[model samples]
Target chain A: MTLTTTLIAGLVLGGTYALVAMGLTLQYGIARIMNLAYGDMIITAAFAAFVVQALPSMNPLTGLAIVVPGGFIFGYLVYVFLLSPLVKRAPDKATLEVDSILTTFGLLFVIQGVLLVLFGSNYTSYTFLNVPVSIFGTTVAANRLIALVLALTIGLMFYALLTRTRWGTALRAVAVSPQSAKLVGINTDRAAAVAFAMGTALAAAGGTVISMYQTFTATGGVVFTMKALIVVIMGGVGNLLGALTAGLVLGIVETTVSTYLDPGLTLAATYTIFLAVLLWRPEGLFGRRV
Target chain B: MLTLDALSVRYGKHIALDNVHLRVDPGETVVILGANGAGKSSLLKAISGLVTPEPGVSITLDGHELAGVAPHRIPDEGIALVPEGRGIFTALTVDENLALGAYSRRARAGEARQRDFIFDLFPRLAERRKQIAGTMSGGEQQMVAIGRALMSNPRLLMLDEPSLGLAPVVVGELFDALGRIGASGVALLLVEQNVTISLELAARGYLLEVGRVVGEGSAAELKEDPAVRQAFLGLNA
Candidate 1:
């Protein structure tokens, strides 16, 4: 019974991690943006969900319809206004990486500051579908179950889109080889912008789901960012399926450690696994050596 | 027709191409023959919009000027370049690579037919449609590159050293495939160091030396020229 509970809880947490990590992977992989501000985007959407839930008839799912598109537009505008110039000026990928990291680091503070001013530094969450539901003789919160289902559905849909559609294939081509993508007549800049926007949309969706079951402070964006980054690197950067698997593994391990050992050691356990992966497989678990 | 007039490209202090003038008529096969560092790759790169030519240079496909067109847009203008080193997406499957070949709007309408044509042209690609391209041998990768370029339904197909580093037997088969592609009425602009096979494949040839076109003639005329025989064919006449 305890094992089943741990597995379910870990899966719920892992589903959210997978959801968020996919967005980061898309941004870093296709757009080539490190996106240090990614978690801030999530928190922003969470706050948006919170505000919507406080209204008379609005719900987080309804908030998703607004927040996801808003996230996409915000990301597109950011790319056009904030990042395109850097892309044009940079001579090579290495230079672009350095430039983007610095630019987004500044962007991180700007977004976090805005979030702080708007929502304050208080831990915020909303109660939604808090009823307990039984699954295989274990009871879990209905909201968390919904989040898991939504995350898996969205992630799988995204995976299908990437593998099935021509446009998605072109995006993957850009990620795989941008120069070669141009040879096939793909506008790499436009693709990057769209990819960045899609990533942001996913981040928004993840945030909306997370808001239902977890309390998130405006200043706590860094932790989400770190966790997502860890999952992305563990799965292999730019690899969608890898991100999903790595996220679940990380979630289960974290949960198992917190349950069996001490909850205080979860972060230490996370870092231990991360350091081991880095030392053993720096390219990532699924990444191939170039 | 594709026309280039006074095309010049420089890399810092070194001029890679100098006032090069050339043309490829519809459905015609033209080959550029030169030794190493003779600016062969630059000419193809210039046409494909991968490299910017000097100001006042003119590059037109049919009646449209292509001097400042973006590289990705060039495929939409009916030009496809199989660059040196076979720039196929190594991470993608053969089918996915070919599907992406028809990504340009112009090629999208005829994607199905173009894919069929590619499969017919390189039957090996049909068998390896699901296989990751990076695992293929060098010659097979070149086939994927050519098939990918053809999938764009290009009017003018440009190749830069397609036979480089391939085994002699593979080179022979590759040219045989190129010969069939030429027969299908796509104008071919080839840059090759292998003089004998290229001269046989092309109706006309241009000799580029030090980034300039030093000689131009029919294949038969150049094949018999003593200077060509000595310089390229390695025959002391």
Candidate 2:
């Protein structure tokens, strides 16, 4: 019964991780940016939800009405104003990689600082759904189940868009080879901007879901970004389905390790798994090791 | 018609094309023959807007200047380049590659007809439509490249060394396809080291040596010129 409960917890955690990791994959794989600022976008959304929840008789989910489109436009502006110019002027591929990392790293701190200034470094959350529901002889948090369901639904929607839409086809092609994409008459800048918007919008949605269950601080962005990056690397750089599966696997491992061993060692276990995967399967579980 | 007036390109200090002038009228096939390092590829790159030409170099397609236009915009203006080594999106399926080729609004409008025409022209592509482009043989990839360019409904089709790494039989078939493309009223600008096949397909030709145009004439005149025979035809003149 304990194992069943743990597994349920793992599944919920996995869903959240999948949501976050998908966003990182889009930013890194499609836009070709490491996007250290990715978690900052999440933090921003979390704060936005917190503010909305603090308002009289307001639901934090309503924050999505603001964060989703706001995050996309913010990301689009960042790509258009900050990243694209650097990409355009980059002398070579290696330079673009390094420059993007450094630039996003700088942006990460700027966003974190702005959030700290505005929100005063408080650990806050929205406590709307704390009810427990029984499932197969174990009780699971209803809020967590809701998060998992929402995540899975959104993931499916995202997958359909990627596989079934013309924009999705163009995005995939641009992700693989921008030069070929351009030759095929794709406006690569617009493709990249859209990639950034989609990625950041997903980040915002994931953060909103997270705010419902966890007390999060401004500095929480770093740890979240690191975890999402691990999931992305373990899955495959550009494979979304790989990210979903990898996220589930990670959540299970983390939960199991915390349940069996010391809770403090969970972070260590996560790093160990990452290192093992890197040594054994550097191309990731779903990627063809190039 | 496509015209290049005093077109020049440079990579830092290394000059690739120097004050070269060339033109191709509608439905005409023009070939540029040159030795290795003779700026042949650079000439194509300049016209395709892949590289920015030096100041005062003017490229016009149907009297519209294309010198500073972005590479993606060139295809929209009815020009397509089958780059050297066949720049097919290797990971994409053959069908996806062709679909992407018809990406411009004008091309998209007629994509179905163009796709049918391509399938008729290269039946192998139709058969392997679902196959990944990278897994195909080199000659087949060349066909995909040519077919992809055709899908764009280009008024000017530029080819850079289409015969490279191809078997003689495949090369013959490729040139035959080029001949058919030229006969279909699309202007052809071919840059090749294969003088014999190119001369056979092209109506007119130019010899580029060290970034400069050294000779220009009808294909028949170039085939018999002592300099062309000595340098390109492997004949003692």
Candidate 3:
């Protein structure tokens, strides 16, 4: 029974991680932007969901209809107005990586500042569907179960879209080789913009679902960002299936550690795995060696 | 028809192409022959908008000025380039690479027909459509590149060193495929190091020496020229 409870909890956490990391992969892998502001975007979406929930007869899930598209538009505008100039000025990918890191680092602080001013940096959460339900002889919170289902559904949908559609294939082509993408008549800049937007949309969806089950503060975005980044690296940068599998592994490890040993050692366990992976397989678990 | 006038490309202080003028009419095959550093690649790059030519240069294809067009837009303008190193999406499958080749608006109408034609031209590609392109042999990768370019339904196809690192037998098979593509009414602008097979494939030829066109003639004239025989064909004058 205890094992089942831990596994279920871990899966819920892993689902959120997988969804968020998928977005980061798209931004970094396809758009070539090491977006330091990614977590802040999630926090912003969480806040948006919070506000929507405050309205009469509304919930976080309903907020997704607005927040997801809102995130996409915001991502598009950010890429065009903030990042495209850097892309144009940078002579190569290495230069662009450095430039985007510096730029989005500044953007991180700016977004955090705005969220703090707006929400006052206090841990904020709302109650909606906090009822518990039994699953295979273990009781779990209904909202968390909903979040898990949503995350898995959306993540798998994105995976299918990437593998099955022409536009998605073009995006993957750009991720694989931007120079070759142009030879096939794909406007790489446009593809990058779309990819960045899609990434933020995923982020927004993850955040909204997370808001349904977790406490989030205006300044708490960095923690989510770091977790997603770890998942992405563990899975192999730009490898979607890798990210999904790594996220579940990390979640299960953290939960198993917390349940079996000391709860405070969960973070330590996460770092131990991260360091081990980095030392042994720097290309990531699934990534091909460069 | 394609025409280039006074096209010059500079790489920092180095001149890769110097006021080079060239032409290729519709359904024609022209080859540029030059030793290393003779600016053959630069000329093709300029035509495909991969590199910018100097101001006042003119590159027109079928009455469309393409000198300053964006590289991505060049494909929509009915030009395709199989760059050095094949430039195929190595991570993608052969089928995906060909699918992307028909991404341009002009190629959408005839995508199925073009794929059929490419498979007929290089049956190896049809056999390995599901294989990842990078894992393929050099000859097969070059076929994917050429097939992908053909998927664009290009009026003028430009190739830069398509046979750079292939085996001798593979090079022969590759040129045979190129001959079939040329015979199918697509204009080819080729830069080749192999003078013998290129002379046999091309109708006209130009000799580029140090970024300038030093000689231009029919393939027969170039093959018979004593300088060409000595410099390219490796025969005593």
Candidate number of the best DockQ: 1
Candidate 3 — what's its lDDT?
0.92
The residue-by-residue lDDT of candidate 2 on B1-237, one tens digit each, is 888999889999999899999999999999999999999999998877778899998899889999999888888999998998888877678887888898877688889988998888899999999998889999999999999889999988999999999999999999988888888888999999999999999999999999999999999999998989999888988
1 or 2, which is superior by DockQ?
1
Q: Which tens-of-lDDT digit does each residue in A99-191 have in candidate 2?
A: 999999999999999988988787877686789898889887788888888777777788779756666877887877777677778888888
lDDT of prediction 2: 0.87
Which residue pairs collide, candidate 1?
none
TM-score of predicted chain B, candidate 3 = 0.98
| Residue A279 miss distance in model 3 (angstroms) | 1.9
Query: lDDT tens digits, residues A194-234, model 1?
Result: 99999998889889989999999988888889999999999
Q: What is the C-alpha lDDT of each candidate?
A: 0.91, 0.87, 0.92
What digit string (tens of lDDT, one per residue) describes model 3 on residues A1-290? 39999999999999999999999999999999999899999999999999998888877888889999999999999999999999999998899999999999999999999999999978999997999999989999999899999999989999889878888999999998888898888999999999999999999998998899999998888888899999999999888888888888888888999999989999999899899889998879986511
Candidates 1 onward: DockQ, in order: 0.70, 0.50, 0.67
Give the CA lDDT, 0 to 100, for residue B126 in model 3.
Answer: 86
- Evaluation by TM-score, superior candidate among 2 and 3: 3
Instruction: Please state the CAPRI-style docking class of candidate 1.
Output: medium
Per lDDT, the best of the predicted structures is 3
Model 3 Cα displacement at A151 (Å)? Answer: 0.6
Error of 2 at B108 (Å): 1.3
TM-score, candidate 2, chain B alone: 0.99
- DockQ versus reference, model 3: 0.67
